[model samples]
Target: MIKWVAAFLGYFLFRFPGAVLGFIVGTFLDNFGGSGNKASSVFQDYTRQSVSPADFELNLLSLCSIIIKADGQVNQRELDYVRQYFLSTYGKEKANAIFRTFNEVIKKREVSAQRICAFMEQRTRYEVRLQLLHFLFGIAQSDGQVSKAEVEKLIEIAGYLRVGRNDFESIKAMFIEAADNAYKILEINKNATDDEVKKAYRTMAKKYHPDRVVTENEAIRKGAEEKFKEVQKAYETIQKERGIS
Candidate 1:
């Protein structure tokens, strides 16, 4: 892990030669048992409370590429959505570098959702994974409508990410409108009583809260905020329809 983080920082900061230098340094640290305390504050910057943020960004790019191509037709709006997201979370220069890396590397590769999610499943927290779903859905729906191909691809990716079926359905309901979408977003059934509906709303509100995702990354926290809003919207929709407010 140290080696991976080091290599990323090296490359991100200095490109190829720096990557080799970083790998050598990381290997030395690992051999000397530096992970306990020898890891410098600089190293810790990459590996925060959770996985390496740099690593997460690379994996996120992979997933973004997959979803963008899912419908077989790439829309400019979808492309712009990704670009705008990066620009917002990271300043223009960093965002441009990130996208530069993406276009040069990730765009050329053959993305395998199963493989990407397999790594994410082990490394990512549940709340963070849920936020990933929300982000992907936004991509799929950015072009005014989500194609059938995109939906199927998203489901497959969710399965690989090991996201629970109900959780996936709950997020899906936010973007795909349906008669029972509000109930689904609450992870409840229409047959649920008013009391049960209230309970479900509480549960979902807690689950989707932005604070649930432990991350310093503004983009991820932003995604969680969006999910949290969807949950609130769902609860409101249900209350209005049932006259239970």
Candidate 2:
């Protein structure tokens, strides 16, 4: 059990900064316990745990710091959006702690978005990665518009994470309002027939629905819900435009 825990910690130690690794190790240890046969069982359990919500939260904040700083300046609106998101998801005390870590991460000159995204791809599930992309769009649009630089950075990070073009465009359209936003959000061509539009909408709705996220964490679930709502809004916009029932 100790060997497994040490190996896991070592993996993070190599990939993440000391402070983030410390927090992750602490969280894992806090959840760890048992003796003899029980200890072996616990080790097996821990090995199967994959990535916990705490792990996801820490990585998310770290990546967020990188995205916010992508444009060479971290705007107040972007920071405020992140704070409110943390507070809503983690409560005031935990949010403050994570926010402190985020600030610390951004101050370091060595942590790049490419490294972080690669690390996240190794640890996170597909749904969580999608949510991370969605969150980045939220951060980029916090100042009421997504800049070209932010879009480029997002594409770069998504590429590192191996997020598909269709999935990435689906999330992008949710934030960027334009005449063809509905088609982009559904990942369909603008020339689709009404039946094709309906099919696309159903497919996207199923893909982005909050229930599709296989996590018990309410925060993560809520983030998925927001994406699900965006999918719904896109479908509705297309329906209205085409006068489809």
- The model with the greatest TM-score is 1
- Write candidate 1's Cα lDDT for 1-245 as tens digits: 67878988899899999899898888887755543543232223333234456777888888888888887766789889999999999989999989987786445647788988987887667788889988999989988888899999999999998899999999888898778999999999899999999999899888888867866667778999999998898889889988996
Estimated TM-score for each candidate: 0.79, 0.77
Clashing pairs in 1: none
User: How large is the C-alpha RMSD of every model relative to the true structure?
Assistant: 10.8, 11.5
Error of 2 at 28 (Å): 21
Number of backbone-clashing residue pairs for each candidate, in the order shown: 0, 0
Report the lDDT of model 2 for residue 99.
Answer: 82
Residue 118 lDDT in candidate 2: 73
Candidate 2 deviant stretches above 4 angstroms? 1-49, 216-219
Cα lDDT tens digits for candidate 2, 70-183: 888979999999889879977899889888888887787756778777767875567767887888889999999999989998999899989999999888888887779878
Q: State how far residue 150 of model 2 sits from its true place (Å).
A: 0.9
